[model samples]
Target: MAKADITLRGRNYSIACAPGQESRIVALAGQLDARLQHIASAVGDIGEDRLLLISALALLDELDAARRTARPSPEMERKMAEALGAASDRIEALAARIESGG
Candidate 1:
């Protein structure tokens, strides 16, 4: 096993991973820390727990959107087009708000 030390929101965490995966773990933590920082800047550090929840939801939303568009069958694609559009719009609006520091 290998351990990676990462800092997020000014706190440090040591995470264990496969021997060769230490760098990947560190990179993932970096990405997560970046997301947390962006959210904190936008919302003014509501709380670590809340910020984590919001960040998780945002990531899940992106994953869901990606899954929905990932080469679905023609019928499925047609059925999902409207819903995907709505989701994309909502995601975009949320991103805009965050970017604008709201």
Candidate 2:
């Protein structure tokens, strides 16, 4: 496992992930924090736990919408499959690099 040190909302956390995934994990945390900040701005000073809960719900809502709208034509499906495969290859390569300590 690799450890990533990241700061969100002025707080620091050490997160562990599969080696090369540290940057991606940090990026995800940043996205979550941005959502939390937006919620805070709109609603004023909610407690930390409530802010986090609301932020999660907001993101989940987005995911649900995306899932619902993702019915694609055959050609578009093929293209999306290709893109996903390429992304998978890149992730595998990054994992290999981390495993080799490169």
Candidate 3:
């Protein structure tokens, strides 16, 4: 395990992660802190817990929007389906030829 110190809202917290994941954890904490700061600026000095809550909700909203937009479109889905169907047909034909001892 690895330990890292992260600062958020002017407070320091120690976090532990897998040996190689410390950098990733630190980076994510930075993102969270940035979001917290942004929220605090907009709604001046609403308690820490409230600020954290709002930041978490805001981050989740952003994640949901990204997921929705990143999903495969209808055209992409159609192309994938066509590709899979072609591969399946080739496999079945190969199996049939083997069964016939040719």
State the C-alpha lDDT per candidate: 0.92, 0.89, 0.92
lDDT of 2 by residue, 1-102 (tens): 799888878899999889999989999888878877888999999899889888888888998999988879899999999999999999999999999999
Worst 10 residues of 1 by lDDT: 68-77
The parts of candidate 1 lying over 4 Å away from their true place are 75-102
Best-to-worst lDDT order: 3, 1, 2
Evaluated with lDDT, which candidate comes out highest? 3
What does candidate 1's lDDT look like per residue over 1-98, in tens digits?
Answer: 78989898789999988898988988999999999999998999598889999999999999999997786798887879988999999999999999
Q: How many clashes show up per model?
A: 0, 0, 0
TM-score of each: 0.68, 0.67, 0.82
* Whole-model lDDT, model 3: 0.92
- Evaluate model 1: give its lDDT: 0.92
Candidate 2 displacement at residue 99 in angstroms: 43
Candidate order by TM-score, highest to lowest? 3, 1, 2
